[model samples]
Target: MASKVIHAIYTDDDILLQAVKQVRAGRYHIAEIYTPFPVHGLDKAMGLEPTRLAITSFLYGLVGLAVAIVMMNYMMIEDWPQDIGGKPSFSFLSNLPAFVPIIFELTVFFAAHLMVITFYMRSKLWPFKEAENPDVRTTDDHFLMEIDVEDHDVNQLSKFLYDTGALEINLIDNK
Candidate 1:
């Protein structure tokens, strides 16, 4: 089976935003948009659901904090109790101030690194991944919008895109 899609290219981000709004207002479904840089408020403009990555990051941070606490307690208090600088090592609670920096660093490190990995995995991006943009120009200065052509009149869609200030319009058939 072959599916048809229209690719509309725009040179400016503002123009692309307006086009997206107009397309949505016209009840047309936009499959995706590609831009060289992040466009502010694009997710809201496209009606995309809110992301849950922040919650995941918080959970990762908590895990890191817990690991740091356990490791510090075992190494500094239980495993080998040592008074480094007149600070008592027998009680973990009394020496918690000294471990604050380590705990903070580990929490930030785990959250950042794990969040990046999660994003990559969620987006299916990895080493040797092929480019998915339909037009190479979209990787540079152009923005590309993909609209599904299911049961819609191609000519009308093209004209509407043109009226929305698309630089170039292309119809693609994917089988």
Candidate 2:
């Protein structure tokens, strides 16, 4: 299958931002955009939903904490029952001070590692993956917005994009 896309190029982030807003306001569906750097408010302008990574991190931390508690209790109380610091109570909660460091370290370690893994998976990134950037200039000084020409007149859309401050525009077919 083949599809047509319009690549509207911009020299300024502000101009690209305004073009995106205007294009969206006119009920046009933008397929994607590429920029040299992160543009503030771009996600909000694109109406993307908020991510739930914070919640996932919290859960991962809990899992880490639980593992810490279980491992510490089994080792210190149930298995060996050490008498460190002359406090031989032989109880898990009684010796909690000795396990605090492990608990904290494990919690942070699990949350950070799992969050990174989740981000990579969600973004479809992995080792040995080929780059998908369409234009090398987008990584330098240009911003490119890709719009699908599904049912609209290409001439009208290209003119509208030009009016929105696009420095250059090109039509490409993708399969």
- With candidate 1 superimposed using the best TM-score fit, by how many Å does residue 103's alpha carbon deviate from the native? 0.7
> What TM-score would candidate 2 get against the native?
0.94
TM-score versus the correct structure, for each prediction: 0.95, 0.94
Question: What are the per-residue Cα lDDT tens digits for candidate 1 across 57-81?
Answer: 9999999999999999999999999
Give per-residue CA lDDT, model 2, range 8-91, as digits (tens).
Answer: 999999998898899999898888899999999887888788999999999999999999999888888898876777986578
Candidate 1 TM-score versus the reference = 0.95
